[model samples]
Target: MTRPRATVVSLNQRIRDDIEARIRSGEWPPGHRIPSEHELMARYGCSRMTVNKVLSMLAAHGVIERRRRAGSFVARPHPHIESVALDIADIPLEVTQRGHDYRFQLLSRRKRRPRRGHGPEMQVAGDGSLLVLQSLHLSDSAPFALEERVIGLAAVPQAQQQPFDRIAPGSWLLQHVPWTRAVHRISAVNADAEQARRLQVEAGTACLVIERQTWRGEQPITYVRQMFLGEAYDLVARFAPGRPARRD
Candidate 1:
């Protein structure tokens, strides 16, 4: 029999959304434990069953996690945020959700200033900053793409804590931090010696290049060049048949 005049389902959804928002906002990171059922029940004035339903749903969706006796907690290590498009903004959460054999390698990192010769456009930055991070994105242990990224140390100071071996550069950036704005440019080019060798493809192979300029409010936050082995990937874009397209 159903209970009458109770805020069970509604409360479940409310708490669920709250937890999801926290994760998206980077308050709750990967592999982090979520509140226990008892805590959630008390927090929301709901029953244990209500909290259990919400948590079960989240686990099914690959968001938070649940353990037998350890209780529920946030998932702080799931690598989500790569498979999504550049424009929708949040990418890390998506990458982590995709249960694929993925890996990353850090090639280089440097603290430097943008070259003056590159002109005022590239030279401009908040706090006279730039942290150059070079990395390689991989799937199933095979090199997939090359990343050349410039980070604004002011908005995200811990840019150095990124572990290239465990997180894709894109996933790492989105999950651990937040951005105000970003400009992504995708193009194609023929692979050079270094690119070809790393990608295990023949020289002159066509490759897709993705360039991004990110911002924090009005201040630019990052500039990134992501090069992909084009022949192996197909970038897909989906939309409603009637939704108006957004201008870049």
Candidate 2:
């Protein structure tokens, strides 16, 4: 049986979705040339303007590239993004699950004024004192990650008293605070002398950094930076697109 054709009004959008599906499914992998506008126009029975419009949107979204005299091809695969879980991660459990002995050392715990730029970042009223915890995570006795965190006392007062040595601050905060939101910025950096010593890597080594901020309603709960030796880790994320509702 033949599939019913799309309506005129939905043609452009359906065409766009079909093209994107091919790219996402790796059918048209990076560097693969997509059909020309004329070819696509004939295949989809759409006007040139509609096809061009769809291609422009794809290019703007970095899914395809248009080159003079070269037509368009799938763009080189960018850092793929998958929806991340908002819940706090269990670092020790993650390490142990990966077949390694997990351990951590609480290097320092102190109450200090927020750094020059931290006050605004934390959305606090003043450069007030914050509980800072510095720790090192190890996998099978090898340095895995270094964590530096600052807690807003007003948001989680118990942070001031908790000895993070017994429970990682991340785990502690997840258990104590009712955070409604979180933001994560993942990036690569060249480890400096200080970070190098903390992660037990040579200076100038590449590292993966996760700068995370958590909030309870409008109040900031904590800001932490977890840096790991890049050579020792592979960050993975999985994404599943939303399915259309069933008519039945």
Candidate 3:
């Protein structure tokens, strides 16, 4: 059954427009399956070829999802995103997924005053801050990263008894404590001998450092410094809908 060129083009445009209208109007919400090609062709008076092209193009643009035996569907919405959000690059996670080895070691814990030399962002009180715990994390028997963390004695009365041998402080806090507010800062730092030795990299080499602090209500909960070994890993992100653009 042959159709005129004008008729083919008209049918194609109609099918594309119909699908686009449904998406813009939210009839096809994210992750919701759309009609199959046969259904779309039947409703739009279009050829299967035209429907396939339209769906394939939309899927490539992150607007839809195509799965074998499942037909086409709107994509899953991304997660809540913040401006100047996380951009983690050069941290390796590939080898571990292959069932490789990983390990952690607790170095020391201390209580200290907010000395002026102790980095600017960490401006705490003179009554002395909570506990500072240091440790190293390894992958495949090679040093992977170093973790330096501060704990809120008031937030978690159990901080004193928190063991650090098998579990890194950052992981322990997240699993055992609860926080309401969190701040994260990422930067580059030169490795000191200790950091260098633990990471198995040359001292003074550039490393990615992430500093994060969390609070429960107005009370501080945790402060942490996480340093990655090198540029073998990076962060990928997805975002959800923003607060309905404020209407005047």
Candidate 4:
């Protein structure tokens, strides 16, 4: 057991960042096989063990996939939706506590330049990158909510690395990022054909759409719309006379 040298520690992070930058920049597209461990060891002038550790971390984070004797490749991205609670709570836990089996499916994900109309809502100007995700949530096999989200790449660059199939984007951000303020808008809307299909309800059915935008200080973190089936979900809040409720 030997400790990593100071130079080795620095090199490890540099190597990892370089590889990640290449992947995010599309230089190493999804399913692209990265250079072999031996090649990387030669290129970085580091030991095989250091390269292995770096690759392992990336693989564990779903950023890359490594096969036995086959080498590693960038993973294709998965769609994921982020949600916010005016009073933050674990959504899966909330559903389970209510005695329903919770499940969700990814619908779509895209990273592209925002449309001209999206500028004002996201507080951004010009053509900047936006990460969008759509998903459907179910309770006990019944459609519950449809989530659509747009995240600003400038504020959270790591958003590009997340494939939210296993973890909801909202939950992940809650755990990793800190936010200073959030604004919530609740409204009633009729389910359109697409929303109806996703919710397993007929078109024109009533729904509650909860739109939330959260920021870290002044930089926007994400904006999400959660459309819940009118009959399937409820929004609850508790308050005291003078004190504000807890937020996380």
The 0-to-1 C-alpha lDDT of every candidate, in the order given, reads 0.65, 0.74, 0.65, 0.76
Candidate 3: tens digits of C-alpha lDDT, residues 1-248:
88898777566646655675676567887778999999988877677898998787566545578999999987664454233344322123333564667677778888664556665224323244567788777777777778877775644545676677766676665544433345678788889998888788889988888787665334566677888855743444555486222211
TM-scores, one per candidate: 0.57, 0.60, 0.55, 0.63
If ranked by TM-score, best first, what sequence of candidates would result? Answer: 4, 2, 1, 3
Rank ordering of all candidates by lDDT, starting from the highest: 4, 2, 1, 3
Which stretches of candidate 1 lie above 4 Å from their native place?
A: 1-85, 88-99, 119-124, 161-165, 241-248
Instruction: Note the residue pairs that clash in candidate 4.
Output: none
Per-candidate Cα RMSD to the true structure, in Å, reads 14.1, 17.7, 19.8, 13.7
lDDT score at residue 161, model 2, on the 0-100 scale: 61
- Residue-wise C-alpha lDDT for candidate 1, range 6-26, written one tens digit per residue: 455456657876887787876
Top of the candidates by TM-score: 4
lDDT of candidate 4 over 32-151, digit per residue (tens): 999999999999988899999999867765667899999999876443323234575556666788899988788999987766666434462123578888987778888777898788
Estimate, for each residue in 45-81, the C-alpha lDDT of model 2 and write its tens digit.
8788889998886676466789989999987744433
Which regions of candidate 2 fall more than 4 Å away from where they truly are?
1-87, 119-128, 243-248
Tell me the spans in candidate 4 whose CA falls farther than 4 Å from its real position: 1-85, 119-121, 124-127, 246-248
Model 2, residue 116: distance off in Å is 2.3
List residue ranges in candidate 3 displaced over 4 A.
Answer: 1-99, 116-128, 243-248
Q: What TM-score does candidate 3 reach?
A: 0.55
